[model samples]
Target: MTWSSMLLLAVTVERVGELWFARRNTKALLSKGGREIGKEHYSLIVALHTLWLSSLWVVAWNVRVHPIWLGVFVCLQALRFWTLATLGKRWTTRIIVVPGETLVAAGPYRFIRHPNYLVVIGEIAVFPLCLGQPLHALVFSIANALVLTVRIKTENAALSGSRHV
Candidate 1:
């Protein structure tokens, strides 16, 4: 009903669409001999993200959007798009590594090892700030950092000894 609520709804819809795309990519990669790493912590990552978004919906639905923060959020989405487009079919929500497949080194990947995670970090913080929820931003950003610690380690170990980038 509110502008913030509508924006959150749009974000949720976008997330669902991304999940669908990731699932398809996961299946394809698995069929191609890719193995998923860090399965144990995957559920926690999912729950954290789900709760973050749900909390935003509960607390920010009636809040006015901040133009500056919204602009930052839009910029983060642009980075997200670049990361996704660079990875293309290799992009998924899970840590999947196919043997002999080199890590991506194009687009944002050329600059950072985990561009998608960077985008996610920005989203978790910026989205709440856009809705004028600083506490929400702080809480979720901390939680996401903890999750990313485990995730990045797992990803690093998985990609270790692989081809360049």
Candidate 2:
């Protein structure tokens, strides 16, 4: 299979694993009376990521894949996985702030306040560029940036008022 196709397959598998783990985490949090905030933002995140992935597929469909770019994309994907694993039960597509929960300072959080967002920013550009679609990358990156700005601000506000983990 082509590198792009292989990347897609790997992403699909990883997302499935993430979903399974997230579900378990969600259930545990909910059982503990944890409340979720900014649910609409979660939906927006899903939509934007869907658009980004669709654009990658569209660009890859017509263009010749570059090996160097594909390699970069793979690395970005690995970063994404690492971020997710680091976050563990704390990771969610939504901005859920469990009441009284402490901030996570370990793993990727040790270096960046929002490592997952960093990975997402990289993926938005990396995948499209791998397919030689700078236009799509530009558009989607801008859109994702705007959405992330709102998300980060809200999430920080939510966490700031809470105690440290």
Candidate 3:
């Protein structure tokens, strides 16, 4: 495997680890009375993400990597880590709302409502571009936008109804 493939492989492994961590966090939060919204679309979201990453290897395994796009993707990972660190225990791949908890305004949250979503958007698009696949990036970006449209609305409603604003 080339250096770029190795990078992507490492990331794929990291994503699996994240899923495990998120599940653990989500379980803990739920045990503490966390109310999970958007359950209806949760499966779809999982499938989309799972397929997305898998498709990356299938489609871009041998494609020449674009260094510029990869660099942007690396920057996005920094932002992703920042957002995750800010949320700490509250962060999860799924929308699990802890009732009565105030909105987090620290870290990247201070400047934007959905900083993690921005990272998600960037990853979905940028990673494909990094592998020189514009069609993958474009198609997945549109799909992600559609999914986030529902997720954001669901999350906003839940948050607005609870203590968080």
Ranking by lDDT: 1, 3, 2
**Candidate 2 regions off by >4 Å?**
none
lDDT for model 3: 0.88
Query: Could you estimate the TM-score for every candidate?
Result: 0.97, 0.86, 0.95
Give the top-scoring candidate (lDDT). 1
Q: What is the C-alpha lDDT profile of model 2 across 1-165, one tens digit per residue? A: 775677666666776776787788887777777777767678788888887776566557555777887788778777777888877777776666677778888777788888888888987887778778888889989999988988888888777777755
Give residue 155's lDDT in candidate 2 (0 to 100): 84
lDDT of 1: 0.93
Clashes of each: 0, 1, 0
Worst 10 residues of 1 by lDDT: 102-111
Worst 10 residues of 3 by lDDT: 156-165
Q: Which candidate is the best by TM-score?
A: 1
Error of 1 at 116 (Å): 0.8
lDDT of 1 by residue, 91-146 (tens): 99999999999878888888888889989999999999999999988988999999
Q: What local distance difference test score does each model get?
A: 0.93, 0.77, 0.88
